[model samples]
Target chain A: MAAPILVFGHKNPDNDAISAAVGYAYLKNELAKRAGSDAVYEACRLGGLPPETEWILGENGIEAPRLIESLSEGQQVILVDHNETLQSADGLDAAEIVEIVDHHRLGGLVTAQPLRFNAKPVGSTAAIVAREFEIEGVELPRGIAALLLGAMLTDTVIMKSPTTTDFDRDIIARTAAAVGVDPVEYGMSIFKCRSNPAELPVDKLVNADAKEFELSNGNKVYIGQYETVDLQAVLGREAEIREAIKGLVADKGYQFVLFFATDILAEGSQFICEGDTDFVNRAFDIDCTGKSVWMPGVLSRKKQVAAPILAL
Target chain B: MAAPILVFGHKNPDNDAISAAVGYAYLKNELAKRAGSDAVYEACRLGGLPPETEWILGENGIEAPRLIESLSEGQQVILVDHNETLQSADGLDAAEIVEIVDHHRLGGLVTAQPLRFNAKPVGSTAAIVAREFEIEGVELPRGIAALLLGAMLTDTVIMKSPTTTDFDRDIIARTAAAVGVDPVEYGMSIFKCRSNPAELPVDKLVNADAKEFELSNGNKVYIGQYETVDLQAVLGREAEIREAIKGLVADKGYQFVLFFATDILAEGSQFICEGDTDFVNRAFDIDCTGKSVWMPGVLSRKKQVAAPILAL
Candidate 1:
């Protein structure tokens, strides 16, 4: 086998990110097989595997690509679903970085790959992987098709993400038809699953993945994002979450706190806060209505929303 | 060969719902294949398809299920991902529904074929599918692995949903690894993908597949859900979404509207409204500060938030 192709995802691979890496490796292997090229593809993760990741691996019947902290020496590597800046992928010497497929905003340092680089801010790395299948003219196997769909669903929030493109929709439509899945109900089911909130712990609900940034004034502020089908419904958890956050802030010694109640249906956000509301307002450059600040038509926090506010 | 077992999903089949139906069908076929039975499995849809569903099907190399407006007599059907509830499953019938597998709350109609029913609130139907693979001693093919992962990721909102169980987590870890996916990255990626706000239409963001009911006070109210990873960042889209809802309410002539801006990280909802602010206050039994309300520790509208408030 022409030196095993080390197909791997970024440091922390998500569902679409990891699946795309493996799926593309699978696709590339098929292509090489058709071309009579002797190449082997191995999927690997570079970081600690989470419980959810382990569950996915076991269910899929594939062994975890033995976790290696970094690329092995002499290994030909293909990076999927992340840019260099987000996580350092600079360990590879020039030729080792063969192919790069990703969906985040293109950053510097990743422009030097020699083989192939597919990057789009569309939705998921799976969309990029699906595109590769089309380019190779290979009929997707059932496994590959399902992987692609998973990638798109996760990345696009079932098409609720603004990164979703017409091309993405077209790809999804053709793919769904091929895989015998119904698009409308699939989207609705995802919404319904997200609609129920009673079973969640208050802290896990509040601190699920809150991000904190250090300010120039030596102040640290944290922002948390929650995506639910219904904001009004989550109102039920408000008291518990508020109490938890209040305790957490006191415990963590944070300067300010912000929470975003995002309405994908309304294409807006309601910013909720505690502590220096004025400082929070100045940081975000918005007027709070005491309880929440209304932001209309702001779905993309990375590009359309966060970048602008951060610039301010 | 025996006629292909026609399997259909609940109306508006979500990823977990559709993936469970197809994945289970494949497992049954594998069982039959090993058992020397000539049974084949086919997956079908009950309604118009969603965007991501197509992607899942395409990636899996399967075709989209045929729509079931009015099932003809003698059609063999297996219901997946939803119960026989007009509240959710709408028109999926029992006479044809030979097998019922789902993860939603129990609905009005009990499964006639309770022997084949696999119902549990394990968040995603994919979890149930994974369990089925375990129960039947069927090894999931790579494609099937992808389907299960897709279902789990979407249904659990990348593992942020309250319905996610240890079983769900375990299956997700295993299935992801089997497909050479990284569990941590996959979960985080799904959340990130869902966080993109620009890819979503304001209307779909606010009201896509939203549910409504009449209160005891003769007030009819509608609640829409939108989940994303970056609620604060997407707050910029609030104005457009509010306007869109206003337009939708005007067009639909809805009496009252409520939208939930669920902060997955903060574990609360920033409530927004256009019609009948009093209705929102009455529904949540709280005071409103602006066009928006900050409700903490809230996740689900149906079980945790709405049902309780509506009761009062």
Candidate 2:
């Protein structure tokens, strides 16, 4: 039999990343059982789960995937949530990535073998994994459904983020029903439970949910997003956050660092950036005369923000 | 409504590439019709269709897609049979690629937006397109079934190549039944019509069905395959073919160029290589002491040849 396949997400595991890894492994194993395949599937994580992810998994009675520092040469793996090798686990270059189910922009990941790569323009990787279950005609357990629903709601910001699609909304409703929860009530509770800006350190707040991008002009930019019900609290600590962002930018040699504080309740975001001020001003159409700027109705970093910046 | 999406395959259009472009466009249009979407799907070709592809389309009463040299900036496109920018039309970097359906190894193709990229490890892109039809519950037309079946048979060498999968076989059977033809008989006829190495000039023979790969060692190699009933006919013109290959290598600046003369009837191949003999010997485990080496039961360039060479 082939060695067990390791299914994991990128480093700094978030709610969608952790949920996608677990959900994809379950779906693969169920499909394998129907096909009578002998290969085993194990869900893993590149880093320790964030507090919100830990809470969701614990509440759903799902054990958190084991954290792995690195992989051995020729180890088979299935990546979920992210495809950039920089974002993946250490020694990923030596691993045989058999499948990738991602919802982000394509990174420069090339493989020797032609494997199954399913990337869709959806809000969350969990919605894609849940759709796979529906496509394969596999019945989802209540626990898995809850985890996937949680991921969908978190990633799409309760269907208020610009990244949210009709398909995401459809899957959220079905998965929420399967788990016996009202999506709106549950999503709000999950957001309120996780959004504790006052308690989180400036570093943790900026690095909680971040993505790095290498632009065509060879500029590396990091965008970090933090969602909360209380945006004013985050803006109150703008000076400390700016210092943290500057430190991160210098340490990581990032050309720019932009941290977005998304107000889930207000349906907008405030941006604190340490980068080329002129470029930032033109990209967002906001006059950043101060350290922070409130950009109303700019909830999605993906469609609303990243797309235009990357295109430029 | 968005502008009509131009669907096309890679340069040097083969049967699979041409057929897949047509089939995928048809499938997408059918799905859009059911959903009442205003987006029109127009099939196109990056290069002129091969003689065999032309014949097949003529037999099915399907007009050949308009040949296009390059795309304008921001023109929306759905690539079929290939995803490599190197193999794609010029200005592809500027084009807004919305979706990709392919069966080849992933090249270094990075997109700014998250699009629908469905790449599977199947023998033919036609098979993947047919599976999409099934997934979307769209019934295939008789003409489309014939075109797709012809592509599947040709790409997999009538189920003899190592790239042939069970899913490909399943699609072939269904497509054959829909087209009202015996799969074996129809496949043999297509091969017989196309496998005329003696009639083809040296350049055309090598350029007929070729794929370029960039190795891990930063070496660019071009592997070209020619299918025929008799390998001896190719061996008789070895000197001329070698000269032609050397000219191609010099003109294209390829690190290595290997041409495989595959005998469909014998189910074996003869190799004529023109670069780094030691590396070639180590790559395929064949002693190429002379210009030509006959290897038995090595029919697939993708699975048997390219995979190992690229891995090395």
Candidate 3:
């Protein structure tokens, strides 16, 4: 048999990033088996698992995906959840991307060989992965259904994120039904299982779900989001958070570092920025240079937050 | 209602290019109408229609897509068959691409907003479009079904091209059955409908379906293909074709210009080159410096010819 193809999500993996990889890998394996091809897909991640993802995997008696920092040159891989090089594995430029299943904006990635790319402007990558299962006519295992349902809820902030569309809602409803769980109740439980933001080290909270983006001026900016039920727990450490991010900006020479804490219950977020704040300030029409600004109804980092800043 | 979104294919339109755009735009319009959205999708072609495409549309009493050369800034658009900017319409950088349905390699297209992108490494974009109609549960009108089947056959060289996969064969079969025609018979009729290659003007023969590509050295190259049952007619015009493309290399500063004539019956192509031939010699291990080289089993330009050249 040939070597197994690696299937992974972006670095700094969140629930959707890691869960989508695992689900998509299983789907591909089934497809390969039915076709009688000697191909295997192994799911991997590039970072630590979030508390909610870890909880779901443990509850379902499923092992976490293997952790990998970089890829070998010419290794065949499939990227899920994200496709941009800046947000992918460390050695992505040297690796061969055979397929991609993402739900983010295109990021100027070029490839030489023709491959399968499936993306939709939906709320979660898990929703896309789940829908593919139906299209491929593969039966969804119960444990996998639960895991995917959990990521779908968290990624969409319990269906309240602005990125949620009719497609997301339909898939979420079908998957949640298959898992025998109420969508809202299950979502609340997952958010509650997250590690307490107030007790975490400032660095961990800021980098939990962050991504690197390039501005139009060719400068790199960092945007992070930490979603919790209590926003005050995160805001209480604003000074320390700012100091931690400022250190990153200085050490990494980043154009800026913006961290936002989203309160799932309140459906809003608080933004704290370090380094040059002009982009965020002008994009959102708010000055958060010295103080944190509370943005009402800002739930999704991809759609509501980073998208506007990147547009600037 | 907002402005109608324009849908188009590559600049040098082929049968698959223009036909796929027409099929996809029709599918999008149906979806919008089902959802009660006032989104209108207008199918447009970037270049003159292929003779086969014109025959199919005329046979079905369907109108040809509008011809467009450039796009206005901020105009919403959808791309089909091809995704590379170098192969797309002029002013593509300024237009907003809201969706893409293609079967080619990624080409460094960046967008500020997330959009729907569906690509597969199957034989033809028409196959993908036909599958979408099934997925959306929209009834395939007989005219459109016949139109799509024609493209699927021509693009895959009647299922003889190496790029043809199980997916393409399955969709082609289903669509042909729906249209009440034998697949091979219909395909031959479409190929026979194509205009005689020998009688074409020299420039039109050379630039009929050519596309510009950038090499690793950051230099541009142009590649064109002419497929026919008669290869002798094209081979007889080698002198005239060489003279025409050499003029292009001198006027446009291209690194090289490669043109091939594929005999569908023989399943081979004759490659002719002008300007720098190092790239071609190294890619295929053939010397066509001043003489034509016959490459056996080279039917699809994208899969058999361009892919190897670009990989280098």
DockQ, per model, reads 0.01, 0.78, 0.88
Which 10-residue window in model 2 chain A sums to the lowest lDDT?
Answer: A275-284
Each candidate structure's TM-score, on Cα atoms with residue i matched to residue i, is: 0.43, 0.96, 0.99
Q: Candidate 3: lDDT of B99?
A: 92
lDDT of 1 by residue, B1-312 (tens): 776667766554445656777787787778778878777878766555555556656867976665656555545566676553443343444334555566543333432111234555466777877876876578888877876797787666666666667777888888998988886665555555442566677766776435555554756667776666678755778788778777756776666677777777776777777765676677677765246667776766555555564545
Residues A71-106 of candidate 2 have per-residue lDDT tens digits of 999999999999898789889989999999999888
Candidate 1 lDDT tens digits, A1-312: 367877777654555656777788888889879868788887776655433344445544645665666555556777777544335344554335656676643333322111344555566778778876875588887656755675676557678777777768988888878767776565444445442556766655555434454444556666665655687765666666666666756877766576666666776766767655566577567775346666776554444443443333
> For residues B240-284, what per-residue lDDT tens digits would candidate 2 score against the true structure?
988888887788888878998999889999988896655679887
**Model 3 C-alpha lDDT per residue in residues A1-312, reported as the tens digit of each score:** 888899999889999999999999999999999999999999999999999999999999989999998988999999999989999998888899999999999999999878899999999999999999999899999999999999999999999999999999999999999999999999999999999988988888999999999999999999999999888889889989999999999998899999999988888999999999999999999999988999999999998888898887
Worst 10 residues of 1 chain B by lDDT: B106-115
Model 1 residue B118 CA deviation in Å: 1.8
TM-score (0 to 1) of chain B for each candidate? 0.76, 0.96, 0.99
lDDT of 2: 0.87
Candidate 2 CAPRI level: medium
Give the higher-lDDT candidate: 1 or 2.
2
